[model samples]
Target: MARAKTTYVCQACGAVTPRWQGRCESCGEWNTIVEEIVDSGVGAGPKSAVAGGRPVALVPLAGETETAARVTSGIKELDRVTGGGFVMGSALLVGGDPGIGKSTLLLQAAAALAEGGRRVVYVSGEEAVAQVRLRAQRLGLGDRDVLLASETNVEIILATLQNGPAPDLVIIDSIQTLWTDRVDSAPGTVTQVRTSAQALTRFAKKSGAAVVLVGHVTKDGQIAGPRVVEHMVDAVLYFEGDASHTFRILRGVKNRYGATDEIGVFEMSTLGLREVDNPSALFLDQRDRDAAGSAVFAGMEGTRPVLCEIQALVAPSPLGTPRRAVVGWETSRLSMVLAVLETRCGVRIGANDIYLNVAGGLKINEPAADLAVAAALISSLTGSPLPADAVYFGEISLAGGVRPVVHAPLRLREAGKLGFKSAVTGRLASSDQGGDLAITEYSELAALIGQIAAGGKKQAAE
Candidate 1:
């Protein structure tokens, strides 16, 4: 016979304790420790008969096979992010800031699946059933096959999945709102979230359902609950964008089924979120033939190629400290690059207050954008316009040298697609091999300026 057992667990970080404490010593969270039952004599700490869950070893290749077909979610950008489409029985957690269109995106995906004759059930803990209907109506989605349930009880949701209709795709509006009866903790508690997630994961794997959980992000921009939550799921996705901008990016941080670096771009409208197929064109500035302060950059975000605009404004500083402000870039990096420009390139930027920004509100962490930022600043200060057909990429070193960036081939291909005839970048992986692109290999900032001023011919010949 098994012994009756119970334990207390912290709702913040999944730290288990013998008794409740006023504050959690492990995570330093207050009033989070809650009492819950634990079945003793299990493989791990405790077991439960009612839980009725067990783990099985992964079968040999010959014993099991995959049956998932790549189905487009009707959003081209989204399909690109998921490495073509969602795999069967795969669980994905999507998190973002509030009003970032996380729920709307899920509903859009659900509608697409349902319209294609696939079963999709959306369980909501935040909104009412009619409210969901209204949202669907706004998105022009009136499919009856896309079922809705407004409940937060994890047990009830599982029962519905068991006895009632089984869906091909399941969506939980927000994981923090769900609660399990087995745990005394409230909804969004670490124990409840973990336990509920475990049950859903079991259901998805056993029943061959594709489950999508809409998770909430803390003030620090991390997914709420234990870090184990991300580990438990098959994939983790983050939706991000400025509140003032209509564009949003859905990026995959972890993907077991596909590439993790993939991203999807979308546009918000009165109808709903619309997928942007050609993100490069949308992110690039479209104006007259030439602009002095603006330069084009061919940047790579994972497997995707994106073109963006870098803008710069330079003016003489009035105070002792020159003001340096940058958007979508690192300020310290800007300072370093500015110093390099002043010393190596002989650009008059030391006493100037330089302001820089990427035209779109998109954040760029890739070092490949460094060349564009530097070139834009120099062009603005010197009042020289980079040719409309030229794009820049490469990392800027403190010594004023251009360093090689990753995925050079993909970056060049993307830039070529945008009809750029020439690119100023660091030396390619192989210096001798040059096919279509007229690649200018610049070892230093001074060399790049000479090439850019010579209209690319003098540098290409060198």
Candidate 2:
């Protein structure tokens, strides 16, 4: 008999190496390479797959199909993030940092689903049943009847799940602890995670039960397992928040059944995670409109219109390289905006030590926020407060032009609903309808800069 082969895989990037190395060449992550046997599991050759499985008949694309059934969790935010409700027989992977309320949010959702007459099973591999019970009791969910188990073996879990009728929803707390007898690799390894995820996902598809898999995030805030695990699932939702803040965001990065880039807002409280009906209002809480360098960004998350505060502070830097700090927004985007202001608009904003923040800890990804960030920076540099009742949304080009963004009418409607009086944005497209709010349209970044500086001077004169 031929001996099995072994290979080293980088836990960070899932790159296979011939031998052990101190640093991963693919990802540059140090000490992440681990040895694993490749005789079976996902790393096995094509013969392993074709040797045992029988060929099935291929079906045509034209066929009768039933609409997907949804089970609502009774949590507005959770449902919104899941595109109305959880689709039956779907598999979802939720990833977040430790102590970032991933477990808490799932516990709450399970309880809510149970209350709504859905058979929900919560299998925890990271904590005991008693620990889960304590959290449930604290969240006032002790009265609800939720099936709970503490197990890590994938075979055992699948067996237990099969014994009873297929459940409506099954949640596995932390997929890293799951191990399979088929894989020689230890738990939390790349092969084990991938194999276990494949097993659970296969069960979900065959059993007509929705499965929620919780994943652990690495130091870089990415899910620790192989990227294939994310691809296998039907949806991937990320729970993001700061420990210092009460607000947590559930953003959908990949959804086969729903829209991508959708976000649901939640607030942590003594009882449990409370759904925020009006996220814009909660995000804009305690508005200090009189302060300089504060701008309200009219943004869109999927189809939902959102408004958030963008703040910037510019100060003299003694170091030759001015320090640039950014939070809740991309650092590269900030650098681009700064360069545009300097090279194109002639704003000369590169010499100061700049700090930018998107209040409420909600990260902005769209380029529409560029104009708002620029407004905040210019306002801070000139010590001028923008209009308190105004919201801004536009994309700034490298050639100093302010480009119009999609959903302009939606952004304005949301801002007006929140009592905003005006909006400063790019020229509205013919298809983009206008709202009742006053619109301040701009064509160029330099034109906007001149207006803001002139506004500061006029305010000073008054």
Candidate 3:
């Protein structure tokens, strides 16, 4: 018998090296290189053997194709993030921090789908059948028709799945625990993960079933395993929430069939994950109109419009270097906003320690939040409260100009629906400014700063 070829693979990046090294040259990660037997099927083979394969029929790109059918989980929030529903023969990878309701959410979704008369199979590699049953009972899903299994061997799981009628949906509690006999590496290793994922993906495509694979996240919040696993999947969803908060966000970072930046909101409770139909109202549940540093921001998430509060605190610094603390927003973006305020608006806030936060643990990534954040910082520094019924949304350029953002009509419509009577935004086109809410357009950031400072002076005199 021929000796198996051994190679060193970097667990961080899946880069293979002939010899072992302390540090991975590809990803600069240390101690992540592990020795593994390279399967001949995975790597290059002999040229003589490859040349004997049958040729595949190639189709033109203009050929007609049918839209993939969708299997709705019956959870509105879950379905929304997945672009209406899970597509047939698609593989979705969901990742989250430990105990962040990943399993709970999937269980609830599985139960809902099962109750709707769809065949659903949940295979848990991390928990036993009894433990899963207990969880189902706790979540009030013990009576559902969802099939449960506790297995980790990829071959056995595939065989069992093939034995029954092809399930409408199959959920693996986590992909990390799955191992295959075809690979000579331990479970969760780079090689095993890649091999197992490829097998499951192939099964999904060939069997016409939606496969949902749970993934573990690294300490830095990235999906644990080789990045190639993410590439192999059809869609990637992230379940994010702070342990201290009950709200969980299901964000779609990649989707081949739908929008990539869509988000679905859920509130965790004793009953399981409850979908929030109006996420804007849930996010701004604890609004304090009298707070000086608080400003309401009308933002867009994918095609949906959301209103959130941006809070800022500016205080005298005791240290030579003032502190800058930010939560739910980027720190570097805050620095750029501060620089624009000082250089163009003459807001002497550099001497003060600044802290900014997006309420309800919701992270804002759009530049349209610039105007709201700037408004909050100025309000806090000048000790003035902004208009309670007004919403802010506009991007601030380095040259101190407030730029118009897309979805202006949607943002204003959502704000108006939530009882906001006025909005402060960039100059809007004539066609986009016909809403019931009074709109104030500002072209320069300095003008808005001057108005806020004047409000502060007026309040001080009173």
Candidate 4:
């Protein structure tokens, strides 16, 4: 009898090593290395079981292709995040933190699809069938005709799917709890996750049924599995929201059939997730127009324009190192903005404890928010309240120059729709300045800083 070979694998990045180590050389994560048996016989070619396989036909690139069919769930927000609807024969991986409403959202989608007269199967590996029913009843979806099952064995699940009439959509509650008999490792191990995902992906492709796999996320907000699983799926959607907030954002990080970086906003309520048709209004509902250190930012997410508030506080620091606390925005980007203000604009912000936050728990990633953040920071430093009806957006370069960004018209239109009268932004082309709002163009950051400081002094004298 031959002995089985073993190798150490990093659970974070799937880097395999021959010997055990304290930290992973690939991802620099500590204590993520685990020993697993290596199956040498896996993927080996069959010797005499059958004759040689036939060759596959190849087609030209210019051939006519039909549009992929999609199944529309009645939930418009869910369908929007899924590129209008769930594509047939596609595998989507939805990941989020625990209790972040991954299961709830999927259940709602499944119920909607079933109500539309489509066959839907929801197999749960993490919870019992009774628990799922209880949740459905709580959400008022108990009357839906969605089929439910509770099992984690991959082989049995595949067999059950094969033995019944082909369903239009299949949902796996979670991939971590699933285990395959072929792999000797535990359920959540890297090998098992990869193998199970591959099997489900193959099944979806062959049966022409859309499959959704729920994945658990790590403490750092990444999906808890091998990175290969993400690559194997046709789409990847992340459910994001702060626990303290009622708003939730479903963002598509990767999509083959739709636009990437697209988001669908939902408001969590006692009934279920309610789609927010106008997320801008929801984000700006509690704005304090009279407060200093607060600026409304007109930004773009995918093709949609959004307006949100940026709040900044510049207080005298009591410690040797001033604290820089930020939420819902990148910390390094904040540092870069501060550096530009200090170096080029001659702002003495280093002595203050700077705290920045994006109201409504929405994360803003566009560089266009640079001008808004800078405006808020300067307003806090000078105790000057920005114009109550003005919005801010523009990218600030390292040289303290305000650069123009894309979709200026869209941003201005959204601001104007929200009753904002004026916008402070980079110099715009004549064609992009046809909006109803007043535009104040600045080529450099120093000019805006000077204007705000002068306004503050004038207000104090009065």
Tens digit per residue, CA lDDT, model 1, 110-200: 9988888988889999999999999888888865568889999988998997776668889998999998777665678776788888888
Candidate 3 worst ten-residue window by lDDT: 39-48
- Which pairs clash in the backbone of model 3? none
Model 1 scores a C-alpha lDDT of 0.82
In the range 48-92, model 2's lDDT, one tens digit per residue, is 345567889999999999888899888888888898889998999
Give the per-residue lDDT digits (tens) of candidate 3, residues 1-462: 978888899987789998999999998889999999875434334536565779899988997899889999889888998999999999999999999999999999999899999999999999999999999999999999999999999999999999979999999989999998888888998888888999999999999999999999987899988999999999999999998899999999999999988999999899898989999998889789999999999998888999999999999999999999999999999999999999998889999999999999998899999999999999999999999999999999999999999999999999999999999999999889888999999999999999999999999999
**TM-score of each prediction:** 0.83, 0.97, 0.97, 0.97
TM-score computed on alpha carbons, candidate 1: 0.83
Look at candidate 2 and tell me the lDDT of residue 195.
95
What local distance difference test score does each model get?
A: 0.82, 0.93, 0.93, 0.92
Model 2, backbone clash pairs (residues 3+ apart or across chains), number: 0
lDDT of 4 by residue, 46-159 (tens): 446656878899988997899999999978878888888999999999999898889999999999999989999999998999999999999999999999999999999999
Q: Which stretches in model 3 have alpha-carbon errors above 4 Å? A: 41-48
Going through the candidates in order, what is the number of backbone clashes in each? 2, 0, 0, 0
